[model samples]
Target: MFKLGSKSDADILKSISPSMKVLSSREAKLILRVMDECIHQIEIVSFFPSLLENPEPFTKSLGENLLRTLKEHQELEERHKCLVLDGSHDQTNSQVALSAKAVQDSFRKIVRILRGTAEALRSKETQCAEDIVKMRDGLCELREIVLERLLTSPGEEKQLREMVLEVSQSHAANQVLIDSLEKDLAMAVKDKDEEQLRSTLQQKEKALQEFVGRTQQDAEKQTHSDQKTSEGKRARLQQEASQLNSQINNLIAANREAEVELRKKKYKEETEIENVIQKYDVEMGEKQTELEEMIKMHETDQTELRELEELYDVLDVEYSQIMEERQKAQELKELQEKELEIQSKAATVIQALWRGFCTRKALKSSAKSKKAKKGKGKKKK
Candidate 1:
C-alpha cells in the first residue's frame, strides 16, 4: 500500500521553488488528502479479489463499495482536470502534475487487479458450469445406486452425501433457471416499454390523421355551403333572367302594337288627306262653274260674293287644326323609339348578369364536388 505524505511529490516541489513556496502548507495538506483517498481506493480494489475468492455474505455490498471507490477516483480526475485547466501555472504545477499522474497510475493498477478478479470470476463460472453438469450426471448415478442398494441389502447403504449433492445440484439448476427467467422478465419489461411508446406514437399519428380528415370534412362542408349559396344565387339570377325575358317579350309585343297603331294612324291620316284633296278639287270645279255662270249673269250678284268669302274662312280653320295633329303624332313616334332603345340596353345588361351568375355557380358546384370527393377518399383510407 502506497502512503501519501508531505514529503511526497507536493512537499518536494514546494521546497524547490520560490514561486510555489508561498503556500506549501496548503499544498502539503491537499497532497495528504489526495493520497489518503487513493489509499482508500486501493484498499477497496485489493479487498475485492479476496471477497470474490471466498465470497462473504456481504460480498454484494463489498462490490458496490469497490465501484464507489472507482467513481471517487474518476471524480478526482475530473476535478484535477478542471483545476489544471484553470490557469494554475506555478512551480507547484509540476508537483500537482506528478501527484495527478500518480493517481492515474494507481487507477491503472486497480484496473489490472480488477482484470485478475474478472479472470478469477471466469474460472469460478467454468467450475460452476462443470459442477452443474457433473451434478446432473451424478444424480442419475445416485438413482441407480439407490435402486441397486434396495435390491441388495437396502438398509445397509450409507451414502447421504450423494443425496445431498443431488439436491444441491437441483437447487443450482433451479437458481440458473430463475436467473434466466429474471433476465427474460427484464427483457419483457423493456419490450413492453418500447411497445407502449410505439402504441402511443401510433395513437398520436391516428389522432393527427383523424384531425386532418375532420378538417377535410369541414372544408367539404364549407364548400357544399358555398355551392348551395352559389346555386341559390344562380337560381335567383335565372329567375331574374326569366323575368327579364318576359319583360323583353312584353316590350317587343308592345313595340309591335305601337308600330301597328302608328301604321293604322298613318293610313287613316293618308285617307283623310285623300278625301280632303278630292273634296277640294270638286269644290274648285263647282266654284269655277258657278263663277262662269255668275260672269254670264254679271249684272245681278254682290250678295253672292260676300257668302263665298265666309265659306273660305271656315276651310282655313280646319286646315290649321290638321297640321297641329300631325306635329303631335311625329313627337309621339320619337318618344316610342327612345323607350325601345332604353329597353334593349336594359335587356342586354340582364343577360350579362345572368351569364356571370351561371358561370360562378358552375365553378362553385365543381369545387364542392371535388372537396366532397376528397373527403370521401380520406374516409375510405
Candidate 2:
C-alpha cells in the first residue's frame, strides 16, 4: 500500500508567487471531475464482492485498489493545488487556494480513515465467513447423525420439536421487544428529542445484546447436555454456537457504531440549538434591561415635566400679580394729574378777583378827594 506523505498541498503552494490570476473555470471543472473519479474509485474499492467464498484475495485486491486510488487522488489534489496556487494574484485568489487546500486535506483524512475502516471490516468479515463455513460443515455432519438416529428412534424427534418450539417462542418474544423499541425510536425521532432517541437506541441495542447472550448461553447449555450422550456432537454444536455468537457480536458492534454516529449528530444539533437559545436569552436579557432603562428614563422625563409645569404655573401667577400692580400704579398717576390741574385753575381765579377789588378801591378814593376840594373853594369865594 502507498503511504500518504506528511507534506500537504498548502506546504507546496506556499512557495508559489502571488502575482498570477486564478484558474480558469474549465481547469477547475477538470480538477473537480478528477476528484469525483477518485471518490468513485474509492467507493468501488470499498464495496464487497458478492462472490466472497475466499476473502483473502478479495481483501488484498480491495486494499491494492484503495491504495492506488488514494495515491492518484493525492496526486490529482496536488496538481489542482498547484494550479490554484499558480493562479493566486489577489486576496480572493489566495483565499480560494487556501480553501482548496483545506478541502483536499480533509478529503485525504477521510479517505485514510475509510481505508483503515474498510481493511478492518474486511478482516472481520473474512473471519466471520470462515466461521460460518465451519459451522455449516458441522451442521451438515450433525444432520447426518440426526438422520441416522431418526431412522431408529422416535422420542428424539419429539425433543427436537420441543427445542424448535422453544427457540421460536424466544425469537417471537425478542421480535416483539425489538418492534416496541423501534416504535419508541420512531416516536423519539418524530418528537425530535435527541436525548430520548439516543437512550431508546441504547436500550434497544442492549436488549438485542442481552437476547443474543441468552441465546448463546442456552445453546451452550444444550451442547453441554448433549455432551453426556455424544462428545463429538457436543463439540460440533459448541463450535456452531460460538460462530453464531461471533456473528451476533459483530452485528451488535455495527449497531453500536451506527448508534454512536447518530448520537454524535444528535448531540451536535442539540448543542447548536442550545447555543441559539442561549444567544436568544442573552439578547432578551439585554433588551429587557434596555426596556427598563427606557422606562426609567421616561419616568424621569415625566417627573421633570411635572416640575417644569409647577414652575411655569408659579411664574404665571407672579406675572399676573405684577400686571395688576402696574395697572394700579397707572391709575394712581392719572388721578394725581387730575388733582394738580384742578388746584392750578382755582389759584388763577382767586388771583383775578383780588385784582378787580383793588381797582374799585382806587376809583372811590379819587372821587372823595375831588368833592372836598370843591367845598373849600366855595367857602373861600
Candidate 3:
C-alpha cells in the first residue's frame, strides 16, 4: 500500500508494522522514518489547505501516545537491568549482562505490560538461584553424613567418634548463621529500608540452619551410640569365638578317645567274624565235596543222554535212506504201468488194420464176378 505512487502517513504506518516485528537496526530505522512521515503529515494537515483535515486528531494523539509508551518501555528496561544486577553471579555476570542488554534493546519495541512481565520472570530467576544455593548446601551436608558412614564406620571406632565431633562443630556454625541473621534483620528495620527484604529471608535461612543442626546432632549422637554398641558387640563376638575354639579342641580330644575305643571294638568284632567265616568255609568245603560227587553222576547221565542222541541220529539217517528206496520203487511201478498201457494200445491198432484189409478183398472179388456174368449175357443175346 505504501507504493511510491501513493505514499501517505497511513500507508507508511502500515509498512512500519513488519519492520516493528523485527528488532534489528533496519526495523528501528524504518520506524524512525514512519514517525517522521507521520509528524510531517500532521503539520501538513493542520496548516496546509489542499488535504482534508483529520478531525479525529489522529496524528498528534498517536504521536503523543507512542512517545509515552516508549518512555514506559525504557523505564521497564531500566528496572529489568536493576533486577538482573541484583541476581547476577560471578559465573553468570558477563553472559547475563550481555543478554540483559539485548533484552533492553528489544524492550524498546515491546509494550509496557510485556516488559513488566519480563521483569517478574527475572525476579523469579533470582529466587530460583537462591533456592538452588540453599538446596546445594543441604545436599552437601547430607553427602558428608553418607561419606562418614560408608568410609569411617569400619575398624576404627575412634574415627567415628571424631566424625561426631565434626558434626558438633557444624552445629555451632548454624548458631553463627542465626546471629548473623538477627543482626541483618535489626539493621534492615532500623534503617527503614523497604527494599532490604532480606530479614524474612534471613529468618528462613536461620530456621533451616537450626533444623539442620538439630538433625545433624541427633544423627551424630545416634551414630556414635551405635558405634559404641557395635564395638561392644564385636568384643563379645570375639570372646564367644574363643570359647567355641576351646570347646572344639576339647571335643576333638574326646572324639579321638572314642575313636580308639571304637577301633578296639571293631577289631574284636572282626576276629569273631573271621572265626564264623572259617566255620562257614569248612561247611562249604564239605558241601562242595558232595556237589562234586553229584556232578560226576550228572556227567555219566549226560554221557548216556549224548549216546542216545547219537543213536537217534543214526536211526534217522537209515529211515531217510529206506524212504528214498521206497520212493524209487513206487516210481519204477509207475514206469512199468505206463509201458504196459502203451504196448496194449499198439497191439489193438495192428489187429484192427488186418481185419479191415481182408474185408475189403472179399468185397472186391464178389463185385467182379457179377460184372463178368452181366457181360456174358449181353454177348449171348
Q: Which residues of candidate 2, in runs, are more than 4 Å off?
A: 1-288, 367-381
Q: What is the lDDT of residue 338 in candidate 3?
A: 93
| Runs of candidate 3 exceeding 4 Å displacement | 1-256, 275-294, 365-381
- What digit string (tens of lDDT, one per residue) describes model 1 on residues 1-381? 222322445544433323322223555456545554444444345444444345544345336655555556666777677667766455367766876986687576556646535434434322234444455456556644433333332222233334445557766777788898899999999999998999999999999999999999999999999999999999999999999999999999999999999999999999999999999999999999999998877744566666676877787787778878887888888888999999999999999999999999999999999999999999999
lDDT of 2 by residue, 197-266 (tens): 8899999999999999999999999988887769877888899999999999999999999999999999
State the displacement of the C-alpha of residue 44, model 3, in Å, after optimal TM-score superposition.
99
Candidate 1 to truth, TM: 0.20
C-alpha lDDT values of all predictions = 0.66, 0.66, 0.63
Each candidate structure's TM-score, on Cα atoms with residue i matched to residue i, is 0.20, 0.24, 0.28
Go through the candidates in order and give the clash count of each: 0, 1, 0
Pairs in steric clash, model 3: none
Worst 10 residues of 3 by lDDT: 46-55
**Candidate number with greatest TM-score:** 3
